[model samples]
Target: MDDDDDYWNTSETKAKAFNFDDDVLSTQEILAIGQKSYSPSGPSEESLFNNISITTVQSAAIPLSSLVSSKVLDLILLAQSGKDPSKETKYEPEQTVAMTLKRLTLGRSCSLHVHRSMKSKTELLDGALAIGDGNAVLTVVLFLIQTLNKKLVYELLSSRPVALNHYIAFLQNEGKISELADLLTMLGRSPEAAMYQYQHTVKTQGNNVDVLLRKLTNLLANHFNQPGVDQHQAKMISDYIKLLEWQKHVNKPDLKYNSVIQWLAYNCTHHWHEGAGNAMSPLTLCQRHQITPLQYDWVVLNVHAKSGKWDIVESLFTKKDWFGRTTISSNIPIETLLSRLSQLQASKQLLATCVNKVANSDDRLRLAHMYKIHAVVIETLAKQKDRSALTNYKMTLNPQSEEYILAENTLRDNSIKWKN
Candidate 1:
């Protein structure tokens, strides 16, 4: 018996001395232990029940019935509570729509949800608007506009001045110029509306120049002939007409003339003097309109060249620079000018003077080929003396032609001279 007791004491001491640090508890083991130790009557259970009761009491403190008559709101709350909202709330479509709009006007952030809810209740919204429910009308109208319900928005804004004004402001903010113009006209501001429509049409539909002209003429003759219209506005219209007429004459049917007309209109509006004479020359018009050198050349080609105004065409090339400064002695390459003159079949003296002004070999060759000038061709061929250039020039003409034979002989003579 005493040996047994001593052995048992030794075993107890060894068990007490075993290292616990090496045997860490895993998460599942710890959880199992926690579950085993848990009791329903514990302090944690009491605190949980107290918290739940407190939350229930707080929720019951607010009378939701008096605040929102919407079954949809009730359903939304039920959904947030993880319950079936549709089963708990009564189905009242009209009341739900009215409540949704009210909530929207009261600055709720659930507009998308409200819109979804009100999708099928448009008649309720319209009825509310008809009965002069200002709040509901504004909310629904803004919603329709936001959702791009153009048909409804137009219907609502048709006869309602206040609503129309709001829609017009919205269209203006969105840069819907055509819609804004139509609304403005409906509101009896026809002259202002016409101006906007005209500007818009000119910008977007400028290819329809005849239509634009007709519209402008009708506006001037019919709409803007009132006493209250500003004279400057009238002047603007008249200047636009003149500018359009000028562009119509200058550009072909296939050409884009809007930009040119816009430039003219800009200058006519800003730079033109009221009493400026109608006798203004093309150069004066160019100067006033601030035409670039490239644009000036285009005008000369299209207008002066086609009109048999050779002197005017020459003056365009000979006169001022782009900024209206005198460029007669500015050493411009007259190759292009000479080419144009050659096309017009100018006199030999004139061509010689122009060719002398630049004195480019290439220009002389081009002139010789362009006009079939024997003297210029012989001079250029002798100067260059390139066998290949002479051959190519001969090939471009008839094989047995006099010009070809002369060019070949010129090349042979130059080769003999070089050999000497």
Candidate 2:
């Protein structure tokens, strides 16, 4: 029995020794344990706990909170009892404020305590603004607006224009356009405020076209015309007005086609009279509006022809100047006009007149083939006397073999070049 008891005691001692060795942490285990103790709850909550854990670890390479919590508590207690922490230590005011702000960023719980611990309103404002987190600064601003004087809150926000702009953007994103406009107006940005107001009005009263137009006109005359207004902004407003006018006219059945035509005519005439040059012309507008050149020419021709304005139609085919520059009325190619005129045999005289102006041999040949004008066709073929033209003319002759060979020989003889 005595031997058994001694053996049992030895085994128990060995077991305790083994457990103690297991509990002794290695260097890596020590680091992991330290991190676990100070680490935040989860990744989603990282922002709230970043300054406390990861940032602290990166700066100090260790968890200072584990080593210094008790001492910090004692210092706080002493400081509350009329002892200054800075006076008894090397802590500077800037360092203290920075540390406090970092702690406050941990969460609402830390924020409440740190906010109360701040020495003054100025320190709180400076700390919050200095952090530069949009949501955090917004919370601080709301707190100030609620608990502090309005004038003081305004002063604080005004001092940080970048933060103010961010807050304004946040409000706008939240669909609080009215509040954004009011805030902009308070900041003496009347033009921006008016723009926001106009946007809001447009979104709400979009169906009320006349009212919206009047409101826009008023805004342009009152706010946009100011001396300090941006030139580009003014131009944008003008373009919007033009777009609105176009949309308004296009929506009406009676006004749709005529309005566009009239607008094109007015712009072309205006550009010509003002010598704005060729930057904007009827052809350009037609192209921009996706109107085909044929369709455009047809409109001009039909309108003038119906109005008994043959002079305009004639000018459309007439050569205007030595430079070959012509008015919009005279812009159609002669070949195209002749092809169109050939479709109406009553317009044969007009077709002949246009063909007389043709300067290119291939173009005259093509027109003659297209219109079956025998005189022009024979004349053009005789002038060229090439194999292709001779073959073409031979095909046109009666199926008399003798006549065909005679015509071919005549063409070949004409094509022969004699030595001078």
lDDT of 1 by residue, 292-392 (tens): 66665654454545556666545645555587643333223466666666777766655655554546788667766666665466657677655666666
Report model 1's TM-score to 2 decimal places: 0.32
392, model 1: CA deviation in Å? 5.5
Clash count, predicted structure 2 = 0
Residue 244 accuracy (lDDT) in model 2: 60
Q: Which candidate leads the pack in TM-score?
A: 2
Model 2 misplacement above 4 A = 1-104, 109-119, 225-227, 231-235, 252-420
- Indicate the worst ten consecutive residues by lDDT in candidate 2: 270-279
Report the C-alpha lDDT of model 2 over 249-334, residue by residue, as the tens digit.
Answer: 44643433244466465554444233322434566556545556666666667556655566666666455566764423345676
- Model 2, position 417, has a per-residue lDDT of 44
- Top candidate by lDDT: 2
In model 2, the clashing pairs are: none
